[model samples]
Target: MTLDIGTQHRDASVSGPSSDLSPSPPSSPGLVSTHAAAVSPAPARKPTTASNAASTSAILSWSDEKVKSCSSLRARKDLRRNLEVDVLQNIQKALRTSPNPFFNDPGAAAQEALRQAQIYKAWIQDQEGSSLEVAIVNDHPQGPADGCPPYDFVWVNGYVHDDTIPPSDPSELQGCDCEDDACNPATCKCFQKAVRFDTLNIYKESKQFAYNADGTLQDMMVPTYPIFECNSKCGCSSACTNRVVQKGRRVEIEFFKHQHYGWGVRARHRIKRHTFIGIYSGELVSDAEADRRAIVYEDVGSTYHFTIDPHPIKLETMRKRLASSPEGRTMTEEQLMQRVNDWTRLMDLYQAHREHKVTAKQLKEFNDRQIVEAKRKGEWSRRWQAELEAELAEWEARYREEPDNYLSLEPEDQARAEDLSLFYEDQQEANELTVDGALHGNFTRFFNHSCDPNLATWPVWIEEGSIWRPFFCFFALRNIEAGDELNFSYTSAEEVDDMVKRLNQIQVEQGTKPGTKRMKCLCGASNCRGFVFG
Candidate 1:
């Protein structure tokens, strides 16, 4: 059962003292900068009203009275071992007594308090010295469903899985060898791959990074590429300019109720363009399990499964694939040299293209260079070209008239698409994953939908070793004011419009209308569409 932690928070809504029923241990040591709300006795007061509940950082403060710092060997571990169990028992009792529906049972609210105490404390401790706080609040008028949580889940900051362990330590083994305290874009080993290729086998003349000096994404538009940050594999210190998403969220966030929208998120302070908020996280399940849950969630009137599509990551995987190419297969000096020559010509072609077309001089130079290189290699290059032509012909036959389609595809996508979805059983090649955020997630789970959004999600490769498992980090698409709700489009209205047209045409031909799931959109934006997930 999901518990709304905010509902329990309403009990401690009075502005001054914390007055928590049970005071948890003080903030963990070594994390001196990040303080847990200290608590003290408080006079009986009113529950949180809409005015004070605007931002619950003030309402939920444990105390202004500071406890002694825990710098010594005598750090307190005063919390009861059976706290979660005891809370669960109490919740069971609350459920049995309550006449309201099970979803809004008082027990649900109580369990949420314990879950928050456990989860938030652990999440804060996971990242040393992190001052980030995702405060939970509710402004919904008290009623049978007043204790309703935004969504039911055992909130977690990291992915929850039984068998899928986290990526191996990147910093210890394969990390960058640079000794400089901060990484330099000119030579940092991590940026080398990103700077060299615009896509797999495509080259660029210069390095361009989207991350600004202050750790903000400079661009908020549709991304042409995913940001590869200085990860656990980087030798640079914490201040590296390229280190943004891995540093974790930097600002204050709140999960609060909206009058119309069930639950929504907002920042307490002004957010500049492209600020890194946090990643979309949850239970990491297989594609098949995700499908099972999809049916279950829909029947239950909610959906939390965010599919992890590997299409966007196909290009990013080239760095590793290219490194170890020809390891198994044999190649002569002439063959390797020919391969290099072909790559050089490809780089030229890519660099020469502007608005998807190349200039005549550059095209002539590219063709001349390729012809010269092929002649230089003689029979070895001739054999290589014949083999490539054979391979291309075989691939083209599968697509029929769509012979050049692979040109627009990432190498990995093309490879899988060759075999078709039915044959994609190789675990590494076919990453069919879905994050069940309904049951496990951070504050990011509550972000509502909008037709015109202020936030946009960009794939970011942090320490997650698999490019397929890159984090979906949300960046501020525009400068956002304090107290404004944060949102992103679930799916574009344009896509919806196109789908509707296609579906209508199909139904007209069949003389039957098949039912489709449609969740009406209440975003109320200037460009608001009537519905979402239509």
Candidate 2:
């Protein structure tokens, strides 16, 4: 699925650090901080663009009274901390002190649990608002019945909500068209509301938010979150968008936009290696169902494995099987096994016939066979014989190098292989079809095909419960600047920059001069790796 949050409207003047926003001294680039803009001097002029009208509104409203209010806000650091602590404490009480009794019991424990949940929910709202006045609306069972219902409880920045619900069209967050004193809703319809829910949402969704059996909160959780978005949505008011979902104690996937076709995602925020973005959800099929769908394959080792098609399989038969029954009752395990046996036997028979035919021709060759007809036959036989010998040699080498790679196992082992392969195949199929399952749902997908990339992808696995949960993270292997199309090496595992040298080795073997290895990169980083590594 693709999430195209076109035209994210950050104040160009208010981004980054306070120092960065100010004009820099002759010796260095300017540094600015969005957070520290509180004390900065007012600009001589105002931003007049429609997109910037919101900032201008805030600026125009700024007065000595407001400045005093800002000072009061700056002084209230402990309030934020207290809100966070209250959330933590409530979560701890829910896990430890609360009893898991039936709702029939209206005891103190159950009441207490409800109370704690309300408190925690309240904390979520405070986090969303940063101040207490604004409220984040979570789905309350009776709201828009079709969309993601629960809004962040907190009202911090980065919070998103559909202002127009069931009775209205999805609102396209728009800009303020103020130029020439005009209010053009066509050009400036900022509809979807977003508040800063990133830090709080990440906090709540992270494993750190989970309570221990004794009802204590984990103290080691990091509160910062990476959230970014584009500046505009181009013309399409309805394009796909994505979010990082936190499930249970561990952050797995919150599904991206499940509706829409050809959806893809790019990072609004810079994500680091090993971050758990999300998961693939689909119909889980049994081995028999997989075989009936024609997704089964037998390898050289005679190991049966299932594979979902590398591409979407549009076959009507497969579609019927998936649609007809939840458990796929149409094909039985016995029938699937019978089909597998028949297919394997037929394949073996064909192999034997070909081998015998080639062997017979090879044995007919003789030194005295020099007649025109004989020579022609001999040449043909020799070619087949040579091919057969090469195959035999390859098999022999494989057998000697890794004899155990092939398995000769009992019926149960075969069944296990069939089951394992089917599960894998099913997952692959879901990945291709599911909106958020595609790897392209993140910025890492656009990373150009470079033998050596300036970016690198790393797999993150949080080991727990005898399972290693896997997620992918991307990092800048080399410094990147704004506006540079990010690039990463095509080869997996190696960082992009390292892949460059590896590519040179291949080029060297092919006897080509990999000339002028470095060029100024378009990425506006101060420390860009000068060379492009495709």
Give a tens-digit lDDT track for model 2, residues 287-398: 2332322111111001011122211121212323433555545655434333444333333343333333333234335322222112111111122223323333223332
Query: Candidate 2 — which residues are off by over 4 angstroms?
Result: 1-400, 405-411, 423-446, 454-485, 493-534
Predicted model with the maximum lDDT: 1
Q: Extract clashing residue pairs from model 1.
A: 18-62, 521-531
* Model 1 spans > 4 angstroms off: 1-137, 144-151, 164-173, 200-206, 310-312, 316-430, 504-514
Clashes of each: 2, 56
* Range of the 10 consecutive residues with the lowest summed lDDT in candidate 2: 295-304
TM-score of 1: 0.60
